[model samples]
Target chain A: MWDTIIINPFINLLLWIYMMVGNFGVAIILFTTLTRVILYPLTAKQIKGAQAMQELQKNKRYLDIQEKYKGDKEKLAQEQMKLYQELKINPLSSCLPTLLQFPIIIGLYQALIQSIASAPLDLLKLTRHLYPDFLKIPDLIPLNTQFLWMELGQPERLYIPGISFGIPILTIIVVITTYISSKVIAPPPQPGANDQGAMMTKMMNIYMPILMGWLSYTLSAGLALYFVVSNVIQILQYAITGKIYWGNVFPWLKKTEIKKP
Target chain B: MKNKILTIFIVISVLAISLTSCSDMNSTATSWGGATVTDSAVYFADGMQVIALRLDNGAEIWAYPEKAAANRTFLAAPVLVGEQLIIADAGNLLTSINSRDGVTQNWQFAGAKGKYIDSPLVVGETIVAQNADNSIYALDLKGTKLWAFTAEHSFWAQPASDGQLVFAPNFDHYLYAVNLETGVLRWKTELKASLVARPTLVDGVIYVGNLNGDFFAVDSERGTILWETKVAGGVWAAPIFVDGLLYFGDQTGIVNILDAADGSVVDSINVESGIVGSGVIVTDGIVFGKENGDIITIGFDGSNLGTKTVGGSIYSNLSINGNLFVVVATKGDNPLVAFDTDVKQSWVYTTSKK
Candidate 1:
């Protein structure tokens, strides 16, 4: 079911885009951009839902309920639910969209791997997934894996003269972009909110980039390219929404308090 | 609070990684290693070692390296040159070992940047090897680089030569003819689809098939398509020519027998399973192993001589030495099985690992 619904369509669409552009890297960027565009509304809703929940933390009634039912755990939960309903906030709204996007990310990764088809068996398996009605397999196949100095099928490395080892240039880019995207999309540290949630988020902000970098360093350059492009697009999306907290990424540039008499 | 969101993100990331790991995304073994035979031994690359089995009883003769390394993989069929066996690994290293004991390291070639998918062709004093890096390296007897012919795509099929020009089939849907000595492009004939199987060069003509179900007979002197015909399915194995007839199988399990003079289907037999490896011509008939673990023998008149189930999908071409016909399966208790002329099971060689 996953192959039929997600992987097959994604592979065919990627091939179609590759056919039109004649470049695999460009096709990846375009396909990712198109996916983000299609999911724009859900992303917007998710952002709004998260912001609303954040705002609810500062609400007077919400805080009163927390204090009033501090002694009674069950009562506190019921009051919180009532308060959420009154404010027309759904806690799951933000998470549902994120969960929905997970399949796309996984599907795209699988599709990219299939489309590359570096090995003989990989190419043979790819032939079974191709939709002849949608595109011509003969013309699109042996997809131009070469993009700049990197072969999209292999891990990217930049070889320089006299250098003993090739540098992981794409991995570095992926790490930086992932770090920046995580910080940019993160809701700014709520004043005096030293909760476990905030602590976990901070930890994730560090570990996620390292994990992404490690994956990029090990996996195919095409997937690393996808990660880099996805991160950049995410950052751009948050920036466009006027919700990006650049101060989270650049602490030195954060505005200092201007005390006046 | 926001902790739920963080927790969900963490869970999702872990799930994605777990799912990706479960998929075939990181698989390096593309296909089963083909088997090469001599008088007393049958040599093949199995996972981390090149194994030699006794031809008569399928007993272990010797294995190279002696110890298996987790980082190394040998998948291409080992080509025997004199007393040495040339083995290509997935690590882009080609090494030649003494065939007698599989201990002495003859020479190693580490110039290619891609994995060696097919066995290198030994033409006189030159070793012409096809690499997934889109180049064919021509090395000398001492493992010295001589010349290389770069193509647009990776080569899955081994190159055929007429002692002068090397005819290489590429995944770019072209059959390139390169000079055996200088590695110069003689001519490249564009087929309808990607060519995965080796082309059959007989007399002065090249017979090849493509993934588009189109078979062609191209003039070797000048790269021109003489005749083309559609088959039942996409052809993944090279066509075998015996006498004046050419026999081959397709992805749809149809074994086609055609006239070599012109591209005409003389007779065809449906074995009900896909065939990825070319068959060998036996005295009784032609023998083929299907993807469904069936070993089939068909006559020149398209009659089924005999059939036996080997219990694993056979991907490597059937290797025959004397009356022993060897078949390598993708998975089974007995991965390597041999048969006689009557399609009777001779011996089975079990792989070390599952």
Candidate 2:
């Protein structure tokens, strides 16, 4: 009874929102904002870890210690742990916020699929009874899944007749903002700039957008909209705290210098 | 970092605006087409507009645009009453337009707000229709309401009439029978799943399919289940009665022939695509138009009759006029077509209304 009355209806309400909004992209963004605001403390701890990682890079003596212990793998691990402890930094802090988003992602995905007209009946049974027939479009198609030039059920196709609506201009903005945020907030590379970590970051920087674009192409347009919107919102939140980078990389961004207390 | 935040803010502003703006601009495409065939011409509900075509040459006679923007699809094949074409829009209103010029005769019936979803069931001098909220209404030929009855759930399928009783399937998993004239509840039979297909009345039995993939024959007088046979897929398509046999297609693309007398599966054949609308037009020795977005004409011996790849799901039921079979396909580049038993195309046209 509770499943049908409570849990079922709540899930359906979210689906109703997706149907009404017509884009899963916007749905994800709104969901991210609400979650981030709720999990702000955890995100703040992550930022602190990032700040400490940056400060640790500035320690020349610490660099020497790492180099001296580098050859002895076990000893290097101990030394790194010691160094992290001394700096009051936790490595897990850096990944906690990202990991937290997983559950929300699954929930949002379930909600998006449920609201569609073609979704199976069992899955749709999870939907709430808030709007009994909210997504029931007349005649031709049963679900109102159209957004922009793209079908909300399919990936973003960039073509705007004379202009390119490709990759969802909004989604592109999200990726760019996410890239900029990483560059601004992420700690600078240490003396060993060609290290494995640096290589991984470079790979990530190139691969993530490509992956998002590919996903945008195959998956629902609603999801792409969500990614773009959430990235943009986080960027704004970071900017409020002066954590955003306004460096030469993005010459257009307004620059602000950090002054020590 | 600042640049990242700046970029993020800029992106969000754009996405938010675009998302909102895109939704405003994202009007639903009316891909569904239903035609009301008359002696002079055929009236079609194309998207939000009503288009009239000459029955002889399939030429455009007239078009009524923006008649009902409620997204109440014209799925219940158009009903022609004298010179008026009746179609339901989004359950809130039922419109009767002049069959000749596409002029509005009556737009909204008073207190008919449950949102009419099914096509009006024309019985004698009265026409009956069901709404999404399970309200059964009986209206006169001129769109005047005589009586109405509400059931336990929403109504997505068209109502079935057997002269005396109106069998309306409700989303609440019930097959309800109300008197045609008085709109009084006669009897109700609860099922395990929601009934989305319109029932076909044969003899004294109401044969209907449910969401749980079970097709049953219910006694019209007692509202008791006589026999139930499960199909592989949910029956979204209404059952079609040809002669003494019941023919219908399930969502799994299987065409089944039921006994109609005992609710026994007589013959079942699998097709390439899931059956969209109910199977119709059994000609000479062939059965056709179940699924695969194609006009499949199959021999009674279960051999391939003739197939035409019309890329789209069959959303509209087959309408037969003499030797011509009309089937409206959904989600296709070309949505409507008329063909003879030989599989030769009589006329084909595309409407962007949906």
Candidate 3:
């Protein structure tokens, strides 16, 4: 079911784009752009939901409930649920769209790997996923694996003259872009936000970049390119919405206010 | 609220990590181990290490590197050139080891930028190797590169030669005929699809098949298509010629016996499983290993002689030395199994034991 619905379609679409562009790297960029564009509405909804939740944190009644029910943990939960209903807020709204996008992300990664098959067995498996009605496998095959200096199928490295070792340039770029994207798009903590929330945000801010960097460092350069492109697109989306918190990435810059949708 | 958010992030991180790890595991070289057989022993390259075993009882003689190197993976069959056994790894390094002890450090060829999938073709003093880097490299016995012929796509199948010209089947949908001495393209005949099977040079004609199920017999000297015919499914194995008949299998698990003169199907037999490896001509009949772990023997008249189940998938080509037939399988307790012309199992070698 996953192969028919997600992987096959994605692999065919990627191959079709490669046919049109004549370059695998450009095809990947175009595919990532198309995916982001298609999910724009969901991204907007997620941002709006998060903004509303952030605003609810500053509500006087919500703060009073926290303080009033500080001693009674079970009462606190009941009061929070009642307050959520009174305000017409769905706590899961912000997470739902993100949860929905996860499959697409995973599918796209798998499709890229299948499309840039490096070994004979992987290539044979790739043939099973190709839609013959939509693709001319013979003409588009060997999919221009070379993109600039990287092989796209292998881990990216930059070899310089006199340098004995190849540098993990793409991995470094992935780490920086991931860090910048998370920091710039994250909403600044409200003045009275709980310390726990702040701590969680801080943990995510650190963990995400490291995780992305490690993945980029180990996996093929094609996926590292995807991660870099996805991070950049995310930051650009936040910038267009005027939701960027540049102050988080660069302390000298003033933070932007979360725009009401 | 904070706990839920943390939990969600943690879940996403763990899921992403798990998915990434899954891909990483799958992305490692997926080709099966290739084996080469001689009179006394069999040399097998099983991804992690290359081992030479006695042909009689499947006892290990020696393994290269002593301990398997994590960075190196060997999938191509070891090519025996005099006293040295030449093996190429997925790490883009080709090493020539002493065939006797498998310990001596031989000259290594690190010229290609891509992994070596097919074994190098030894034509006298010249070693003609096709690489995944879209180049066919010719090296001397000492591992020094002579000349390279670059193509539009990679070469997965080993190149064949008729003394003067080398016939290389490429994924670029072309059968390249290059001058063996200068590494220059004499002529290239374009096929219907990507050619993954090695071309069989019989008499003066080259018989090869493509992944698009189109098989062709091309003139070796002129690169002109002599005849073309469609098979039941994609042909991943090379056609073997015996007397006046050509035998080959397809991905649909059907074996087609074609007349070598006109490319007409004389008979077809369905084995119910895909055949990726090329078959060998035994004294009794031609033997082929299927993807379903069945070692089948078919007579020259397209009759099923016998079948023996190995219980593991066989993707590598079957190797034969005298009366002994060896096959390497995946996902079983024993990966290397040897049999005879009677389709009876002789011995099984477990790779994990070493």
B1-354: candidate 3 lDDT, tens digit per residue: 767676857886776676576463442346788898887689988878899998888889999878987778888889898898999877688899999999997899999988788888999999998998889999999999999999998988998998899999998899999999899999999997899898899999999999878999999999999999998777887889998999999887999999999999999999999888998888778999898988788899999998888877888888887888888886656789888767678888897557
Clashes of each: 0, 29, 0
- Model 1 residue A164 CA deviation in Å: 2.3
lDDT of 1 at A70: 81
Q: What is the Cα-based lDDT of residue A243 in candidate 3?
A: 80
List residue ranges in candidate 1 displaced over 4 A.
A64-88, A192-194, A256-261, B1-29, B305-307, B331-333, B352-354
| Among all candidates shown, the one with the greatest lDDT | 3
Model 1: per-residue lDDT, tens digit, A39-71? 889899988987887888778887788778889
lDDT of 3 by residue, A1-261 (tens): 998999999999988999998999999999998889889998898888888889899999999999999999999999999999999988878779888987887888778888887777767778888887888667776578889999888888999999999999999999999999878876788898877767776887787788788878877899899889888998999899988888887876752233434
Instruction: Point out the higher-scoring one by DockQ: 2 or 3.
Output: 3
Per-residue lDDT of candidate 1, residues B82-123 (tens digit): 887899887789898899999999899999988788788899
Task: Determine which window of 10 residues in candidate 3 chain B has minimal summed lDDT.
Answer: B21-30
lDDT ranking, high to low: 3, 1, 2
| Candidate 2: CAPRI quality band | incorrect
Which scores greater on TM-score, model 2 or model 3? 3
DockQ for candidate 1, C-alpha atoms: 0.37
Candidate lDDT values, in order: 0.83, 0.63, 0.86
Per-residue CA lDDT of model 2 for A162-205, tens digit only, reads: 76445466456556755765566554466654266555555555
